[model samples]
Target: MSQEIESGELDALLPEGTVVRIAGNNRTKWDLVGKKGVVRNAQTLGGWHEVVLEGSTSAVRVQRNALEIIAIIPHSKVKLAGSLQGIKSGDQSSITKRRKKKQSPPMAVNLGKLDEDTLRRYRRYFNLNVRKDCEKDELVFAVRRHFARTKVDESDVIFRFLTRIGKFPE
Candidate 1:
């Protein structure tokens, strides 16, 4: 899901205090997905960008794919508009859009974050076809694959309503 923005556009974004959103809810990431934050420094950990969310002290190492440019803070309004040319919120030609790749398997680390009993209970409640004898890793894979088949931002009102209320787990 790596985006291919022009280097000049990206360079304009490397300044500190630039605003950004955690992109791609479908991309494997921490709960920061869909959250916004400010660039803390002009540094990259391999491909990861370091940013700090509001009310958080330490920098969050956001993966490159998870980082979406929102605003360039240091630029004047005119300069900012120029820098962000071609970037539009929710446009089909969104700079964030990349060619659809095969769905990635969910990270096992997400499973590790939950207590084992909770994992089993949720899986059971969801009625996932995973067997009782299956290992936790297998169950994780099965559950993620199942969810991947579901669509996002659709016309189903009930699903959107449930999502708006945070009733469904991300």
Candidate 2:
């Protein structure tokens, strides 16, 4: 039996065990009401964030700006997990503390032999300013976010990351 949903009734229907994966724009201003264990993964939820909630057997993409819900898999009823652990943005202490901790030495990479265009692209993209006292590995890790955030083709980005980290699949 389907009942008429009132104001705030839809949010109330969110049962426990919902895994919300957000991307693109709606990552910033979403709030979970009458629910706990809402997980968020995004660099920033600035513009139009896209949220995908995966149920046990199905998933739904919720557009916050438009307040629209696109359901996946109609007949096969899916169960949302109720017992999820909540993850929140880390506090300032953790971020700053980690930065203060010294990083280990860098591995030998023959920086001079690296291709000129490859060097230029990474240098421009990363805006790296190496200091004599700074460690090479730390410099790379520090600019890792810039490398991660560069606007590259989606397929290329995946390939580049996997290649840089050397995590190729068999």
Among these predicted structures, which one has the highest lDDT?
Answer: 1
Tens digit per residue, CA lDDT, model 1, 42-161: 545445566776456667776656677765554452222212233343433323533454456864445556666776886888888888887878777776776666566666777878
Give the Å shift of residue 82 in candidate 1. 27
Query: After superposing candidate 1, which stretches have Cα over 4 Å from the reference?
Result: 1-7, 11-13, 24-28, 75-170
Each candidate structure's TM-score, on Cα atoms with residue i matched to residue i, is 0.36, 0.18
lDDT of 2 by residue, 50-106 (tens): 233332222233333323222221223333343222333221111111123444587
Give the least accurate 10-residue stretch of model 1, judged by summed lDDT: 77-86
Enumerate residue pairs that collide in model 2. 16-82, 17-81, 17-82, 25-48, 25-49, 26-48, 26-49, 27-45, 28-45
* RMSD in Å for all candidates: 16.0, 20.2
TM-score of 2: 0.18
